[model samples]
Target chain A: MLLIEMFVFLGTIAFAISGSLLAIQKRLDIFGVLLLGLTTALAGGVIRDLMIGNIPPTNLAEPQYFLVSLLASLSTIIFFERIKKFNHSIAFFDAIGLGVFTAVGANAVLSFEYSQPFLIITMGLVTGIGGGVLRDVFVQEIPQVFRKEVYGMASIAGSVALIISYDFVSPIISLYICLTVTFTIRMLALKWKW
Target chain B: MLLIEMFVFLGTIAFAISGSLLAIQKRLDIFGVLLLGLTTALAGGVIRDLMIGNIPPTNLAEPQYFLVSLLASLSTIIFFERIKKFNHSIAFFDAIGLGVFTAVGANAVLSFEYSQPFLIITMGLVTGIGGGVLRDVFVQEIPQVFRKEVYGMASIAGSVALIISYDFVSPIISLYICLTVTFTIRMLALKWKW
Candidate 1:
C-alpha cells in the first residue's frame, strides 16, 4: 500500500509538470497553468472514481493531491530553463509515472471486486492516459495518445499484464512486473520514435 | 417530467449538430466527428453526474442519448451545405438547447438535496457549457464559454434565476422562467455581440 501511494505521488508530480510546461507554452496565465496542472494530474482519477460511483473523488477529498500538483507546477515554472534542458529526464520520469499509474489504476479496479479482464484493463488504461488526454485537449491539441508514439498502447499493455498476472502472483509482485513492462515499452517508444 | 425530457432531447440534438459542424471544419475523420458530437452532447451530464456521485452516468446508461447525438452528427455531415446555409436556424436551436440544459442541470442538483446556491449555480452552468468546452478543447481552442460573448455568463444568469425562484414558484414554473431568461440573454448576446 505504501509503495502504491509512492507511485501515485510520483505520477502526480510528473503529470503536473508536464501540464504546467504545456500551459506555459500555450501562453496561459498563472491561474490557467495551475488549473491545467491540477486537471492533468487528478482528472483521470476523478473520472475513474466517478465511473465506479465514488462520490466527490479522492482528489477532492484529499488536499494533498491538489497541493502536490500545484507545487510541482510552480517548480516547473520557476525552473523553466533547467527543466527544459533536462527534457530526457522528464520523459524518463513520465514513463515511470505512466507505468506506476497503470498498475495503481488496475489495482483500484481489482479492489472493487471487478474481475473482468476487459474492464480492469480498460479502467487501468483510462487511469493512466486519461489525464494526458485531457491536458492535451485543454491546450487545444489532438491527444498525443491518439496521434503519436505508443503512449496509450504502453499503458494498455501494462494494464493487461497486471490483470492477467493478478491470480498467478501476489498483487504487489504483479504491480512491479506491470510497471517494468510499461516503463520499458514507453521508453522504447520514445527512443525509437515508434 | 415530460417537458424536461423534451428539452433535453432538443439540447442534445442541437449540441450534437454544433459539434459535428466544428469537427467538419477541423477536417476530422468520420469517427472523430461522431466522437466529438457525442462528447459535446453528453460530456456535461457525465461530469455533473460524476461530481454528484452518480455512477455510470445517465448518459452512458441511456442509449437514446447516444443515438440522438449520432443521428444528429450524421445528418450534419450529410447535409453540410444545407446546414451551413441555415446558420441562423442552427444558432436559434442552439440557444434553446442551452437554456433547457441550464434548467435541467440546475434541477438535477436541486434533486440531490443540495440547497447551496453557489454549488447549484456552478453545477448548472457546468451542465450547460461543459460539453461545448470539451468540444472546443478537442479541436485545440480556448473554450467558447471562456472567450466568446456572454456564453457562460448567460448560463450563469439562468442558473441563478432557477435557484432564486425555487422558493417562490413551482419547480416547473421556475424552469420555464429560467429557460426564457437564458434563451433571451444568449440571443441578445448573439445579436449584440455582447
Candidate 2:
C-alpha cells in the first residue's frame, strides 16, 4: 500500500508539471495555468471514480493530492526556463508516471469486480491518459494520444498485462510487471518517435 | 415526467446539431463529427449523473438519446450549407436547449438531497454548459462559456431561481420557471452580444 501510494504521488507530480508546462507554452493566464495543471493531475481519477459510482471522488475528499499537484505546478512555473532544458528528464518521469498510473487504474477496476476485459482496459487507458487528453483539449489541440506516439497504446498493453496476470501472480508482482512493460514501451516510443 | 423527457430529447437534438456544425466548420472527418455531436448532446448529463453517483449514466443506458444525437449529426452533415445559413435559428434552439438542460440538471441534484446551494448551482451550470464545454475543448477551442456572451451567467441565474423556488412550488412548476428565466436571459445575451 505504501509503495502504491508513492507511485501515485510521483505520477501526480509528473503529470502536474507536464500540464503546467503546456499551459505556460499556451500563454494562458496564471489562473488558467493552475486550473489546467490541477485538471491534468487529478481529473482522470475523478472521471474514473465518477464512472464507477464513487461520489465526490477521493481527490476532492483528500487534500494531499491536490496540494502535491499545486506545488508541482508552482515549481514548474518558477523554473520554467531551466525545466525546458531538461525535457528529456521530464519525459522520463512522465513515462514512469504513465506506467504507474496504468497499473493503478487496472488495479482499481479489479477491486470493483468488473469481469469484462474490455472495460478494464478502457478504464486503465482512461486513467493513464485522460488527464493529458483534457490538458491538450484545454489548450485547443488534438489529444496527443490520438495524434502522436504510442502513449495510449502503451497504457492499454500494460492494462491487458495487469488484467491477465492478476489471478495468477501476487498483486504486487503483477503491478511491477505492468509498470515495467508500460514504462519500457513509452520510453521507446519517445525515443523512436513511434 | 413526460414533459421533462420531451425537454431532454429536444435539448439533445439541439446540442447535437450545434456540435455537428462546429465539427464541420473545423473540417473534421465524419467519425470526428459524429463523436463530437454525440459528446455534446450527452456529456453534460453524463457528467451530472457521475457527480451524483449515478453509475454508467442514463445517456449510455438509453438508446433513444444516442440515436437522436446521431440523427441530428447526420442531418447537419447532409445539409451543411443550408444549416450554415440558419445560424440565427440554430442559436435560438441552442439557447432553448441550454435553458431546459439547466432546469433538468437542477432538478436532478435536488433529488440527491444536497443542502448546499452552491453545489446545486454548480451542478446546474455544469449540466447546462458541460456538453458545449466538452465539444469546444475537443475541437481545440476555448469554451464558449468562458469567453462568449453570457452563457454561463444565464445558467447560473436559472439555477439560482430553481433552488430558491423548489421549496415554494411543485417541481414541474419550478422547472418551467427556471427554463423561462434561463431562456430569456440567454436570448437577451445573444441580442445584446453580452
Candidate 3:
C-alpha cells in the first residue's frame, strides 16, 4: 500500500471515532452511533470524490476504510465510560484527524490535476470540516465551521502550506508541514480568545 | 428570468414552507424552526452543487433564496394552527415542491453537460432527497429514503424520463414529463399500500 493511502485510512478511523463519541454523548442508540461514525468517516471523502467526478466513491471501493470506521465505532461503544473520562485526549485526537484529513483532501485534489485556486482551497475546507458539519447537523446544531473558531482556517492554512511546499519539500515533509500548520492553528484558536 | 430559474425559486419556497411546517410539528423554538426551514430548503441543492463543483454555492450567491426561506418560516410560525388543520394540503404542497425541485435539479445537471448514465441518475436522487435527508437526520428519524418507500426511485425515474425526452421534445415538454413522473411516483407511494 502507498504511504498516502495509509494516512487516509488512519484519518478515516480517527474521524469515525470522533463522530461515534459525539453520538454516544447524545445518547443515540448503538446502531445510530455506528451510522453516525460511518457517515462521518466516509461522507466527506465520498462527497469530494463525487464532486470531482471520481466514480465508485472511495468508501465503496475500500473495505479497509470501512472496517476501520466500524472498529472505531465499536471501540467507542465498548469504551464509552473510559473514552468519556479522557475528554482532552479525544479532542486532540479529533483535531489530528481533522488536520490529516485536510491535508489528504488537498493532496487528492492536486493529484486529480485540478489547479483552480479557489477550488483547491474549498476542497481542503470541505474535506477537513465536512464530517463535523454532518455530525453537528445530525445532532441538530449549527455546523462548527460556520462559527468563529478559526477551525476552518486551519484547513485553509494546511492546504496553502502543502501547495507552497510542493516544489521544495519531500512528500513526507509536506505532510508534516500541513499537519503542523493545521494543528497549530486549531490549538491556538482554542487557546486564545478567537 | 428564465422559466427554469422561476421554477427553481418556486421550488425553494415550497420546500422552505414544508420544512417550517415540520419544525412547527416538532415544536422547536422560533429560531430553531427557521434554522431548520432554511437549511432544509437550501441543503440539498448546496450538496448537489458542491458535488458537481459548482462553487460559491447557489444559496450563498443568491440572497433571495434566504429571504424566501425566511418568509416561509415566519409564515408558518404565524399560521401554525391553520396549517396544522390542513395536513393533507401541506403534504400535497410538499409533493409539488419535491416534483419541481427534482425537475430543476435534473435539468441543471443536464445543462452542465453530464451525459446520461448512472451519474445523472445519482444526481437526481441526490437533489430530490438531500433536503429530506438533512431534515430526518436533524429530527433523529431514520431517513425516509433508506426505508422501504419509493422516495429516491421517484426522482431517478423522473430524471431518466427527462433525459430520454430531452432529445425529442422542447425543454418545457421535458419538464412536464419529468414532473408528472416524479409526482405520480411520490403520491402513489404515499397513497397506496406500496
TM-score of each: 0.63, 0.63, 0.58
Those runs of model 2 whose alpha carbons end farther than 4 Å from true positions after fitting are: A50-57, A60-64, A192-194, B1-46, B54-125, B138-140, B144-194
Please write out the lDDT profile of model 1 over residues B12-99, one tens digit for every residue: 9999999889888878767667767888998888888877766656776556887899899999999999998888988888898889
Q: Of models 2 and 3, which has the larger DockQ?
A: 2
Worst 10 residues of 3 chain A by lDDT: A55-64
Residue B163 Cα positional deviation in candidate 1, in Å, after optimal superposition: 3.2
Residue-level error in angstroms, candidate 2, position B93? 14
Model 3 per-residue lDDT at A186: 83
DockQ of each: 0.19, 0.19, 0.08
Model 2 earns a TM-score of 0.63
What lDDT does candidate 1 reach at residue A56?
Answer: 66
Ranking by DockQ: 2, 1, 3
Model 3: share of true interface contacts reproduced: 0.06
RMSD of each: 6.3, 6.2, 7.8
In model 1, which regions exceed 4 Å deviation? A1-43, A53-125, A135-140, A145-194
Per-residue lDDT over A14-122 for candidate 3, one digit per residue giving the tens place of the 0 to 100 score = 7888888888777776666876787788778776787676754556444667778989899989988888898777667767777888887777787798977677778
TM accuracy, model 1: 0.63
Give the Cα lDDT of each candidate: 0.84, 0.85, 0.77
lDDT of 1 by residue, A1-194 (tens): 58778888998999999898889989999999899988989988887777766666788899998999999999988998889888898898889878988887777777877566655665677688889888987677887664554777788789888877878999999998888889999999999987
lDDT of 1 at A74: 93
What does the lDDT read for residue A61 in candidate 2?
A: 45
TM-score of predicted structure 1, chain A: 0.96
